[model samples]
Target: MVGFEMNDRRKIGIGLTGFGVLFTFLGIIFFFDKGLLAMGNILFVAGVMLTIGMKSTVSFFLKPRNYKGSILFGAGFCLVIFGWAVVGMIIEAYGFILLFSGFWPTVVVFLYRVPVLGRLLQQPFLMSFFDRFTRTERRVPV
Candidate 1:
């Protein structure tokens, strides 16, 4: 039988990720407070690692196709640490989009299963937009 399990580790990971997002939002609201932003960044990375495990996290960031995003993300973190919160967050946002672009479709699929949000997201216009985005290939010519 097909099944899914919600283990403790996964639950903790999800909680951490949610907190990371909250802290990041608060940082922006607080005029890009460096301390909050740094904490957010740390929590976000830790959440991802815990969510996927160390091996998977390393492989994901180290993959040749993801090198650009990985590098930018790392640089952004460094910038944040060095007190350039605004610029670092901007760079991190771009890097985040690049890194998680492939996950959009999966996330959309999951969203479609939700009760309230599903109806909103399933509208033809929204679905079309998401479909177009997910269909575009992001390959680099060797």
Candidate 2:
């Protein structure tokens, strides 16, 4: 409903569960077929993405970044490595895109701090909202 779409956790959970089922189905399509190893690899990669997407529940409930959280993160990373290796054997470009998608957000904060080529970009006086994210603040409802 409206609430699920409004919240990121629900969005990701639904997306993950939906995609997980899809990939499982896709994996089944080539069940027991040695020739379809490529499809199986794709399924494995999709499963990991799905798993990561659904991890918000644990992270939110237990306070992520704790010891157990570190272990969970390691597991996720290992899944990424295993899945990526499988995916790379099938479609290298798609694998890279998926890998980058998994990691792209980590750079968001620092991304806004990168210096531009032109001297004009260095001046904050004429900076736009997107270019000057340093002063940005949110007023979330409690």
Candidate 3:
């Protein structure tokens, strides 16, 4: 009964974050022990993104209106993981594009809320670009 009180999303987030940490650790070990630098780096990056996606997804679940970012984050991590098996470079590139597209805006927003850093982020050009890129409304105005 007590365990059941926790929602599914929380469970999922914990699971994903746990696996991501494990994979990241393994990636580091692989790099150090076997010198599989490229593979290790890929695994590490994917794990970090997976953990981030889990956080985003849990956040989205708490506030359903803002679900798109979580979806994109999860999908991006999946794509990056799958890219390891398929076309390698190209798929990874696309995955990274999707990942950044989904993740950067949230980061910008968070940074903008900070005290001192917010001032720096208030610069016109950067804010304009951040607004345009992160806006969920329209990529190209009609």
Candidate 4:
């Protein structure tokens, strides 16, 4: 029965994260505007901090195992701020994939719990594709 509880702070965190994503998408769609991209990056990082707590966020970025991703992500943020939006985005995308590789399974599981989309994701082809991401041996630590 253990799961995420919908507390006020978490709710606010989710909202911030959603807004961050929306802004980032809009920024990208607008041909990589530096200001928008910088704002989006700020919001996204803030949202993640709020969502996971300041201590956890710091630890996540500071973890020795995450050095490459953290460095790349930070560099990318700097690049965006310095007006290299396209290159920054490319690096950030790579960093993001590396940093969040562990979360893919949880995302897949969450997707499977949705109503209509759950059914679609349960199909053979989709399941096969998703199963690779949701491996039994690679579970995220609770």
Candidate 5:
């Protein structure tokens, strides 16, 4: 049963990656077409979400500690919606960085489980940085 699930996930990831590549190609070919380019970007983001496994990706955003990350993300979206051009892109990049930081623990766990690359996940500095988010402070009752 688990094997079947893993196989399904792999198939989905491959399909999404292929579709993303196709969209990217079409975007390049139709560079003059703004609509197509935008669609390609959307598809590329979708592809990444799928490749990372939707459950894990969604969970990252849904985590309580990561809620603040949404504020930056939303601000970025608003900037883009207002058509701020380059400024919006810059803000969006920062937003993504914050969002990723908020969920770095999940990312670390995933990376640590990988084969060859897993060894790199053991670095003290990296663990310490990511662990900052995983820590919770306790308050004493008066």
Candidate 6:
């Protein structure tokens, strides 16, 4: 879809740069000069928000609101946001160990789209088999 001007772009941006914020924040807290640190912190957070905006922008191409594909795109958007929020919450409540544990799964579910292989693997029997094998690790492509 080429008409997209919003939505998925926001997601792509958000998905790609979250860790950058971590680095920027750490830099500000540890090494940057005080005034520079404050600016860096603000820039880092702004980058976070802009990344989301980019996701929404790019997603529009993948799922134009006026088209039928929009339904799936919108659903994907909701799920992506929800999954990340839950992951972030888990990390906040726990610590880095839990953070990494929670984070990678979401990252994979969002990024790993194997097309034909994914559909074939989605069969009911195959799904259950992998569900048990994978330990209910994820719902997206599992």
Best by lDDT: 4
Model 1 scores what on Cα lDDT? 0.85
Q: Give the better candidate number (3 or 5) by lDDT.
A: 5
**TM-scores across all candidates?**
0.86, 0.23, 0.38, 0.87, 0.43, 0.28
For candidate 3, write residues 1-142 as lDDT tens digits. 2333445645554565566546545644654222232344344444444544556535543455434444544454454355442233334446445444656766777787799998997899878977865686434343
- Model 4's TM-score against the true structure: 0.87
Model 1 C-alpha lDDT per residue in residues 18-97, reported as the tens digit of each score: 89889989999999999999999888898888877789899999999999999889989899989999999999888988
Clashes of each: 0, 0, 0, 0, 0, 20
Q: lDDT per prediction?
A: 0.85, 0.42, 0.52, 0.87, 0.58, 0.45
Q: Between prediction 5 and prediction 6, which has the larger TM-score?
A: 5
Task: Give the per-residue lDDT digits (tens) of candidate 6, residues 9-56.
Answer: 456545445554554356446643343333333453355456545565
lDDT of 5 by residue, 1-142 (tens): 2333556656776676677557645644754243443444455556657666678668776778766775665565455445443454456567678777645655666676689887775588766775565454212122
Which candidate tops TM-score?
Answer: 4
lDDT of 4 at 10: 75
Q: Which candidate order results from sorting by lDDT in descending order?
A: 4, 1, 5, 3, 6, 2
Clashing residue pairs in candidate 3 (N, C-alpha, C atoms within 3 angstroms): none
**Residue 49, candidate 5: C-alpha displacement in angstroms:** 7.6
TM-score quality measure for candidate 3: 0.38
List ranges where model 1 is wrong by over 4 Å: 1-5, 135-142
Model 3 has an lDDT value of 0.52
- Candidate 2 lDDT, 1-142, residue by residue in tens: 2232335644554565566445544544644233343344444444444444446434532453344434443443344345543333334434334434423433433443466633444456534543334343222222
